[model samples]
Structures are given as C-alpha cells and as structure tokens.
Target: MTVSDQENLLHTSSYYAASANDKSMRSELIGEQSCDVCIVGAGFTGISTALHLAEQGLSVIVVEGSRIGFGASGRNGGQLVNSYSRDIDFIKHHYGDVVGEQMAAMAFEGQRIIRERVATYQIDCDLKEGAIFAACNNKQFNELKEKKALWEAHGHDQLTLLSASSIQEHIGTGRYAGGLLDHWGGHVHPLNLVLGEAKAFESLGGVIYEASEVTKVTEGEVCQVTTAKGVVSAKQVVVAGNAYLTGILPDVEKKAMPCGTQVIATEPLTPEQQQAILPSDHCVEDCNYLLDYYRLSGDGRLIYGGGTTYGAREPDRVESLIVPKMLKTFPALQGVKIDYAWTGNFLLTLRRLPQVGRIGKNLYYAQGYSGHGVTSTHLMGKVLADALQGDTERFDVFAGLPQYPFPGGRMLRVPYTAVGAAYYAFRDKLGI
Candidate 1:
C-alpha cells in the first residue's frame, strides 16, 4: 500500500484512530531551524518533554514521522496501570536496595503527572478510575495479595484485595479467581489524551512538525538533526522514538527489541451487554506472562487486547488472532462482532525496566518501556526535561542502572527473544 493508503488503513483499523478527537494537521518541517531542544518523535515521550520544557520557557521543536500519537502512544490498551514493566522486587534483587527503593518511589508518579496535566489543561479524554488485576488461578490470586503488601511497603496503599467470591463485584466474567483493585489505576481514550497534550504543548509555544522523519543526526555541543525536508539544530536533541526509533540511534536500538501487540474493539454493545462484561467499568488485566487486558470504551464497546508478536511483524488476520483470547476471558462475548482491529509495536528490554539517560551529555533518550509505556513514558518525559535543565538527581538514578545489548546482536536478537518468550509462556502455562 502507498503511504497515504497505509495511514488510511491504520486509521480505519484502530478504534482509537477512528474515535480520536479532531485536530488540525501540523505542517512538515521545511528548512533549517534552531531551538533550545529539538526532539525527534512526537509520541508521549517527545510531546510530554516538549510541554514540560516549554513550561520552563525553553524553545522546543518536535519533529514527528507521522501525526502526534500515531504510534503505540495513541493505540495502546488504554489501561493506566502503574509501576514499571518489571516489578520492584526484581530490581531490588538484581540491583541494590538504594537503587530499588529510589525507583520504587517514582512508580506511581506517571499516573499522577498524567492526571495533573489533564485537569490543568482541561483535557477531555473520558478518564476513569480503578483497575483490576484479575487472577487466573489460586497461585496468581495469592500472588496478588503479596503484590499488594509489597507495594504497600513501598508507599502504595490504594490497593484492595478481592476474594474469588467477590470477583464478580468487579468483573462480570467468572474467569478470574480474584484480583487486586488499584484505586489509582484507570483507563482513558489514549489518543484524546495525547492530542490534548499536544495542544497544550502548542499553547505553551512549542513548535511541532508532523510527517518529518529524522534521517540523520550529527552529534556535538550543537546537535544537528536532518529530517527529510528540514534540519533542526539545537543545543540538545531528545530521541523519544521508542520502538519506532529504528536506525536513527544505533546505541539505543541495541539495548531493546521491538515487539508488536494486537487489540480489537467490538461494535458498541447494548447497555445491558456492557454492564454484563465489566460491572465496575474498570480496566482488567490478568496476571500471566502473556496476559490479556480489556476495558469498556466510553461508547460501550468491549476493547480487548492481548497476544504479542515477538518479531515485530503484524499478525495475519489480527481479529482472528485476538478473538480467541477475548472469548477465553469473556465466553459470553464469543459471538460479538469486532468493529476495529490494529497492531502497534513497543520496545522491550532484557530487564523490562525502561532505559533512561543521556548520550555523551548532549543527546538525551529514553525508551525500552516494554508494555508499560503508557505511564512510564510520562514519568520519563518529565525526567528527561529535568535532566536537560540540570537537575540530574532523579535522572541519574535511572542512568546509573546497568544496560546490556541483546546477546545475539541485531541478526539473531529477534529469534533469541522469541525463544525466551516461548519458554516463559510455557512456564506460565504450567504455573511453575
């Protein structure tokens, strides 16, 4: 398909794209321009950084390959689940307590930042509260209790444990044994949220150019980023492309692999049907290596998502691939008709914790959010801006964390990670 044809295809295929709030098309970068910071990629990290820095009176220019929120930021599962992709215990075990505790303190900061921005900017993204972590079996249910305690020990007290008998109170389906409800966790129209943020950034005097893909970067005290139609010279450059940052920065690319996840939205359900699926209207994600997360759209459609493509390629018949998992979660919806199906890629790191730091003290970058980009990206956006402003205390904590490239390098990392995912899937299946 042609570029326009592909974008049209994606726009029609994703529920978010179809339902996004209307916004003016931004102009593409046309000529050489100078700024305090020139960011490549207008996704959450880039846009959020632009807004933060603009608040501090920095001249910011954002260059996006496509329109804002065109990537995973606009098309994710929409569940605002807190914490990093990897739990804090893992960081504490592998790293030391000081680093682990420091990371833990910032676990829920992303959600707070998002909420603050939305209310301050008067964003209307159909924001809702509460999220449920459904347990698949007894082992997982017990683990939920432990998770609550662990998070409580780390200053998170908004969690409530539910027993199997009370599971139906939160979810309509009988698939879950029990779950932990996070009062702070919630869902939203992701595209609307980002679009609103972009508007907010513009209101703060930040410049944004869409359809401007960065082609080359000349690193120095003054970084020069060459796009297809323009060159942006700035004192600092922030590479916030995440998984889509392929080939632009090989150093950041080496530490992560791109993986695609699929999501499908059903036709608007009857009010009764909507109530029958999710009684509390809270987003639900199961506890599994390869888990299923689903929520009800503001218009009453069941938006269910799961299944990962390890090689970062789109799955054939995306609806067919995701429907079975949806049925397994809600058998009552086995015959429900799906209205939209789409796939988006996320950067997955070996340790699953996001990698945030500067490249040679001039080029700043943050990626490898795994599946936790929704909340983590916002936190990193602020962290990126703060570090650029010379407040490096919080940024230094993440930068100090160890990073390693995938063992097989570019040639075999995909297959290697795929094999590792398969092994973990087997373990999750056997409850080992």
Candidate 2:
C-alpha cells in the first residue's frame, strides 16, 4: 500500500479517538491566509509551537493534514518519561561535560514542562504519576543502576531503584529482574493533551485549520506554504510533521525514516485484574531496542504497544500478534480479549538523536525523536518558538546534533530500514 493509504489505516483505529473529549470540526485551508509564523502538522510539535508563539503575541497559523492530534502525538503509548533515546554517557563523551550537563538538565526539564502545562491549562487527560523501566536481564539491570546513579549526580532525587521482588509487587510480571522507577515520569491521555494545547492556542489567539495538507513550499525572504485549498505566506515556517510529513519538505524528510509501530488495547479489566497487572498504575517499558511498553488506562483497560514495521504499513495481525505479547507479560490475562488494535508511524534518525535545524533561512524543522517524543516534543516546541522569537541559544544546542540522509532516498529507504530493523529485532530476540 502507499504511504497515504497506510496513514489512513493507522489513524483510524486509536482508542483515544473513540474517547476524545471533543470531535474537531476544524475546516480545511481556503483561499489565502497570512500569519507571522505558519506551522505544518497539528500534532504536539505544531500545536505546542503555535501555543507558545501565540502566547508571545505572534500571529500564528497551523495547518494540519487531518484533524488535531491525529498523528503519533495522539496515538502513542502515552508514557511521558524523562530521558533521551541517547545515553548521557554518549552525550558527555561526544559533546564534552559542559554541553552534556546542559542536555541532562533539559532532560528532566522536559518532564517538568509537561506537568506544568497540564496543571496550568487544567488538562484532564487522565494524568498519572510514576513510570518504571523494567530490566529483562543483568545487562539491562546494570544499565538501570547506572541510570539511577546518573540521575542522582544531576540532582534528580525522584528515581528509586526496585529489586526483582519489589518490581513483581509493582508490576505483577516476573519477566523483569529489577527496574528504575521515576516519580517525575508518568503518563497522560496524549490525545486530550494535544487537544488541550490546541484549545489553549486558540484561546491565546492562534489560528488552526484541519485537513490542510501542504502540497508545496516556496522559500524566499518570506516562505509560501501552499495547501490543498489555501496558501499561507509567512516570515517563517516550522515543519513539525515528524514521520507523516510527506512531500511538504524534502530536505527534512531525507534525514528521518518513518517506521510503523502497532498497538492494542484490551477490553476493560476488572478492578481485581487491573490491580493484578499494574498495581501502582505506573507505565512500564522493557530494556530492548524493540521493547514492550504497557500501562493501565484510566478506564481499567490494558493498552499495550510494541512490534515495529519499517515501512508505513499496518501489521497483518495487530491484535493476534500483540495479544500474545500482552499475555506473556500477564498470563492471568490469557482469556482477556483485545478491544482495539491500531498503528502509527514514528521517525527514526540515523544518529537516533532528534533532528532540529533550519532549512534555508526561514524554514525550520524538528523530527526524529525516536520513541522519546512525548515529553521531548513539548520541550522542542518551546525551543523552536524561542528561536523564532530570536532566542536561538537553547534551540541551537540541539540543532547542532548531526543528521544523515537515508541511504537510498524515499522509495528504497523503506526496504533498507526493513533490513536494518530485522537485525535489531534479532538482537532483541537474542536478548543482546
């Protein structure tokens, strides 16, 4: 199937969509529009940037290809954890201690930003506290130990180490040896968060249009963004589309490869079963490259996600594959039926670092947060908005990270990534 078809399939199944607070009646772009800043993609990155810019008194316009929160922002595992995909040691060794220290500070700050937004905006998105990184083996256990130490070295005291027995008490699963729990890291109903930000942006006088796919972009002193029905000419354009950003910006797409990840939600569990599965209501993730991440929803459902496909295509047996994985974690759920199965695309960069930089003079883009976009995307929105407002210090810090073009361009890169992902899947199976 084509990318468009795949996106249509993926966006149509999210459980969050079924329970959204309000259905977006936003219209498509029409005629001509003008704003100080025009943002592409109405997911977290775009809406957050619009909200920040509008708060700064800038005339901001956002054009989303579909309804608000239809992208990975809304359809993710919703684990708002602090920590980048890249390790702190990697940052320290490559960028020196000073830069690494700054990045470390920003890591925790990302978590704080999400909490502040939820509280400030009074977003009732089923916010929960605490998250755990469960280790399946000794290597992962050691990694968690080092991570706990690293957090303490950075003056973060919210992380606690749980032994195997304690982990079982917290997560009912004996598959993990031990884990690191963070009080600061938590989960939220991501779709509601995105919608809350959208409403906040509107309240701050921002303009947002749905079903407005940018077909062409003309760059010059002022950038011209042409959608299906309208053109937005602005002094600056921010591309925050992540993996689903098709042809709007070729330069941005080259550095990040889109991969489809599947998720499934089981029928609501009884209170007894919910407590048996995740007693503490904390989100949990394993320590593999292709890891299982699951959490209990506010409605007592088990929302589990894993299994990645390189290309933008839905898995053949989303529920069939994931139901077993979910059962593996909780054998007691052998009879629990899956209520929903869905998929979404997330961008993966060559360096595994987020790609944030300027294209030409006034065109800015940010993508490739890997799977760590939940909190990082919010931080990125503030950074991009600050850069647009002439404070490029923080934004430039991340923009300095290097990104490489996919080896074989758009068409061949899918298969190329498939080959690479197969290797990682093998490693994950081998527990390496």
Candidate 3:
C-alpha cells in the first residue's frame, strides 16, 4: 500500500478492481470511535473476523488504509484452496499425530464457512465449484496421491486422483503429469466476494472506515488505535493487516516478509478456446515450489498467475513476466491478448505457516498465510471470534505453533528467501 501515489490506495489496477461490485468508498475515520473490538485491515482477514464477531453480537470496527478488499484478498488467484500452505502431512510429520489430526479436521472448514456466507448473504461473487492441483512430474504426482490418502484418512473424501492421461480431462495442458481434483473447491471474483462480505458485515451492525490508516496503537486495558485523522479505543484489538501491516507491529512484521505475486488475464476466450484451455472450467494450481495457478473467469477470460517478487517489490512489465508461464501451460494461447496484469502482496513466514498469537491479553493477530489465504482467512476469523468469546481451544493450537523471524532479518530477507526459493524451484524442475 506504500505506493508513490494516493489514488492507488483505494484499489490496484486489477481485473478484480475493474469488475468490483461496489465502487463507492466508505468514509475515513474521524475524531474518536469506540468499539468492543478494533481490527486493523479491511482485507479478507479483517472483514471475515468482523463479520464473525458481529454475527455473535459484538461491537467491532475495522479501520483500513484503503478500500475494502484492496489487498491480496482482492487480487489472489481467487481459488477456494483448502488446507494451509504446509498441509496436513507436513503437520503430522513434524507436529505429531494429534496435532495433525486437529489441523486436518479443520482443513476443509474454511470452504464450508465460505459457502455458508455466500448462501446466507446471497453474495453474487460468481461462485463456482471444483479445483485441481496438477503435478508437473510423476514424483510430484505421487506426492499428491499420498496427500489424497492422508486427506481421506482425515475424513476429506471429496478428492479424486487423476492419472497422467486423465489429467487432460480437467486441463488442456500436457505439461502436467497428473492432478488431484477437489469436489468442494471452487473459485470466485475475489474483490466482489470481500466487498459482499463487507456489506454483510455492515448489515450485521459492524462499522468500517476506509482510507483510515492506523499510525499507532497504544495497548492498555482499553487499547487506543490512532489513525491519520481519528482515534479508536477498544477493549480488544485484532491485527489482520498481514503484508501491509509493516511498521505498525515490528514483531509481527519481522516474523513475515511481504511477497508479491503477479497475475495476467487474457482477453475473453471464445467457447472453443475455453474448452481447450480449461475443460470443465475448474481452477488449477500446479504442484511446484513456485507454482502457477490459473482459471477461467466468469466472462471466459483466462486468468493466469505465478512468479514471486519478494519484499513487496512490484516488478516492471508484469505481463512479460507472467505471459511466458501462461504460454507454457497452454501453448495455443500464445498470441492471446492480455487484458489485465497486476501484482498483489501476501505475508510469507519463514516456516511458510500462518502466525497467530496475541501481543498481550487483549490484542490478537493472525497473518502470514503464505499464499494459501482465500479459505484460511475465513477459518481464522471463525477461530479468532471463538477465541475472543472464551473458546480458545482452536486458537490456542494455532498460536502455539512456532513463529521465528527471518534469518537475515529485514536487510537480507529478500535475497535469502529468493535463494531458498530458487533452490526449491530448481529441485522442482529436476522433479526431485
């Protein structure tokens, strides 16, 4: 959000922005406001948390630096990706069986929460069902098989593993070795989804102030959050800014680095092109360290996204960077006209797991979802609201997870992570 200009504060020049349902902005916070809970951010986490708390009859106010869903929540691949970035197998191997089972049980709950919200609120975000994780090689394909079995054991049986040949049924690409489809997974127009949630929050008596950036937070029995033009006092504060939360909370900022991922949407594809590119119209994410994710938009455009620029640095000519990846997946789309290209940032922790905890007895925070946040943020909202209501069982489990600062600190985190990613990407290329 620290862009050179101020207009960019409202929303980036993204396909989502161009198609946002709500172009109107909320007024900035003025003078003084008070609430039972004050959340800093208007993205998925903030809006989701606010909606959850409001559903339970709590007074909540969200102060955002920009418009609702202006961050990664509005700019991601828009896939309803279930589970955390680390997944259940990694949790089971490293954190033991009980913890793993606990995580697995809640893995698909985010999707359920999302579906419930859409139905309850009658949100029109172009909700569609089905998603696939394609593997580039047999090794990666085997890993997907293992994950399928592991997920099934944890009671997630909406999975179907595809052989190399069967993979073509879902995607037109021959580059993938195999894939795993999730019947419950889907995609959405992300910005509209968050905007709809914000509206839903408003309907529940929640308050939100757009373009009101918090400059300082003084924690006490009653926390005081100071913004550019106003102040908010609250009994509890929840920090949900994620990558954009830098400078406000040094501890949380150091534990995660801002990562920029770019996306490009080709001009609306014809019916024939759509069938060849994304048969069945299911969203697809590859099983690579730096994976590529793409799907057919509601209007039939091919929205493809991949590549990373760490430290929140937006690269020049995003189209040039992403078009190659898109071509590799669907070569027939070589000469397709690109209609949109934009970059969005998400917080990435060293361990690639979300960081959830409290600064004090009254301040709670959750961020660093890595790249899998669409559903996870909704899940965190439920857990955080429950935790605030004295149900800390799930929240405690997540908070207990280890959170470490970057190795080289802020000065070298970008290069350090880039090198590490290069290594893993190299391994992905060699199929090992």
Candidate 4:
C-alpha cells in the first residue's frame, strides 16, 4: 500500500488510509542539499530516526519514494506488541547469554519510545493498551507459558496467563484453549502514528521530501544519496526503506523476502455486539503458525487480519481470504458487512530476525522485521541514532546477527519456503 494520490504508486484502499489524519503530500526534492545525516524512506524507521536525531540537535533529511507511511508502516495490523519477531528466547538459545541478555534489555524499548513520543509530542493515533495471545491448541498454550517465563527472566513481568475457563473475558470465542495477556501490549492507528511522528520531526527542523526516490547511495567520508531530481550529501546515511529498498541496496535487500499480509475491517458494530466479541476491548492474536489477529477499532469496527502471500503479491480479494477466518473466530458476526479490505508487505529474513549492519563506516540499514515491524522499527531507530552518535554498543547487538540469503536462491526461495511453512501449517491444523 502506498500514497497513490501523489506519485504513481498504487494505494491500497485500507481502513488506515481512510482514517489517516494527514493526506497532504510534502514537497519533492529538486535541488542539491546537505545535512548531518540523510535517510532514505519516510516510514516508521526513517521518521523515527529523524525524530530522534533532530531531538539531539542534528540536521537530518528524510527522502521518500512515495509518501510518508506509504509502505508497511501505514498498512500494518497496528498492534504495538513488544520484542523482536523471533523473541528473546530464540536469540538467547542461539547466540548465548552475554549477547542474549543484551538483546533482552532492549526488547520493550520500542513500545516505551512510542508511548513517550505520543505523550511528549501530543500525537493522536487512538492509542490503547492491553493485548492477548490466544492459544488454538494445548501445544501452543504450553509455548505461551514458556514465553511468559522467558520474558519475565528478561526483566518484563507484565504477562498473565489465562485458562480455558477464563479465556472468554478477553476473547469472546471458544476457539482458544488458553492464552496470555500482555498488559503492556497495545494497538494504534498506525498511519496516523507515523504521520504524527513525521509532523513532530518537522517541528524539530527535520526536512522530508516526498516522491523523491533514492537511485544511488555512495559510501565515503561524506556520503552522497541521489534521488530522481536531487542529491543529498551528508556525513552518514540510513536506509530505512524495509522491503521497498530493492535496487538501491541489492545486497541488503537480498537478505530478506517481502511477504504480504491481509486485513479486513467490518462495518461499525453495535455497542452490544462489540461488547460480546471483545469484552475488554483488548487486541487478540492467535498462536497458529499462520496467525489471526483481530481488534475493535476506536469507532467499534471489527478489524480482523490473517493469512500470508509470499513475494508480496496482493490477493485478488482480501475479504475472501480473511472473512472465513473471522467467521470462525466470531460466528456471531457472520452477517456483518466488510467495509474495507487491503494487503501490505513486510520483509521476512531467513533467520526471522532483523538484518542490520553498515557498509563501510557511514552507510547503515535495518530491515527484515518479519511480522514485528511496528515495535522493532522504533527500537531500531533509537539504536541507529545512538550508533550515529558514537555509541555502537546496542548497534553491535544487531550487526552481529549472522546474515544469509534464502537457501534455494531467488528463483526457488519462495517455493522452498512455502513447502517448509506448509509442513508447520499442517501440524497447526492437526492441533500439534
């Protein structure tokens, strides 16, 4: 999904697009410019970085190909779940306690940063707290138990486990055996959140150029970033395009594959219907390998999403794919009209973790957040800003992650990964 109004990019008719607070496109770059740091992409990662850097009294410039929050940042499920996509348990088991603990220390920093920015800058994105992790089977419920314990060991103790008898309080349906509640987890109007942050950055004297796609980036004592109509020179450059950063940085882009996820928003529900479906108004995500996440929007619409399409191809009809899933979760809403349906892409890495590192000494990038871009992207911005200011301690935690291309190369990667995911999906269906 992109900002189709401006540039030639096609915008998905998503609920977020319809509800976004800002629709005006910014001026495009048409002349040479210089800054302390030039960043590519104006989504969460880029705007977050610019906001952090500007707060530190740095002259930062953000250049976007389409419009701010045009990519996944605008099209996400809007859940503010903490931690990385793979979770700290996975990182600790594979990397070791020294680095694992270090990663854990920053697990919840993203949500904290978002909350601080919202209150400090007075951003209005319909923010809310509380999230539920529903378990479809006993196997997944057991995993949730371990996840809660692991997170507690890492300094977070906001989770409370639920039994089958008590699951209905947060989730109305009987589809879950048990679940876990993250008191700190929450949701937001993602597009509005990014737009607010972009405005906040501008208030701090940060410059942003829309419809200015970066064509080339040269690493040197003074980095040079070239767009269609202008060039920006800076001491450092940050590539925050995520899945959209294709040809500009082939090596980094190759390390992740773009995958599309779909979501549907139903017509506003009656107050009683909303109360029946989500008693506590908490966002709920099931523990299926291919999971389903649903929540009640500020206007009482049932926003439901699930299913994945590798290679970032939009489905012929998102409602067709998600409607059945929503019905299975809440059969009482069978007759509800679906008002909006759309699909958006997220970068998935081989290791299911973020890929971050720098080329030479001045060019840096962070992407491949899997399905956890909402929170991880914000944390990456802070980590990136710190690194640019001569603190590489947190930066090294991500940069030290091993990078590998898809096992079967670009031609066969999609099919091979699909086959592997199909196996796990089969087990999920069998309640294994």
**By TM-score, highest first, what's the ranking?**
3, 4, 1, 2
Q: What is the lDDT of residue 178 in candidate 1?
A: 91
The CA lDDT of each predicted structure is 0.89, 0.86, 0.91, 0.91
lDDT of 2 by residue, 1-432 (tens): 468734643346778988888685687799999989999998989988888899889999998887788878989999987878886778888878977887887887777877888898998799999999999887789989999998888878989899989998889988988999999889988998899989889988888888777898887899999976799999999988898888877777887888878889889999999988899999999988888999988898999999888767777878877888888999999988788888888988877778999878899999998889898899899999999999998888898877788887877888887788788778867777
Alpha-carbon shift of residue 171 in model 4 (angstroms): 1.2
Weakest lDDT window of 10 consecutive positions for candidate 2: 5-14
Over 4 Å off, model 1: 1-12
Candidate number of the best lDDT: 3
- Ranking 2 against 3 by TM-score, winner: 3
Q: Compared with the true structure, what per-residue lDDT tens digits does model 3 show for residues 313-351?
A: 999999989999998888899788998999999999988
Q: Write the number of the candidate with greater TM-score, choosing between 1 and 3.
A: 3
Q: What TM-score do all the candidates reach, one by one?
A: 0.97, 0.95, 0.98, 0.98
List the lowest-lDDT window of 10 residues for candidate 1. Answer: 4-13
lDDT by residue (1-432, candidate 4, tens digit) is 344534344346889989888888799899899999999999899999999999999999999988888899999889988888888878889999887889999999999999999999999998989999999999999999999999998888899999997989878889999999998899998999999999999999999998888899999999999987899999999999998887988888878899999999999999999989998988988998899999988899989999988888878989899999999989999889999998889998998999999999999999999999889999999999999999999999999989999987777778877887888889999999
Q: Which stretches of candidate 3 lie over 4 Å from their true place?
A: 1-5
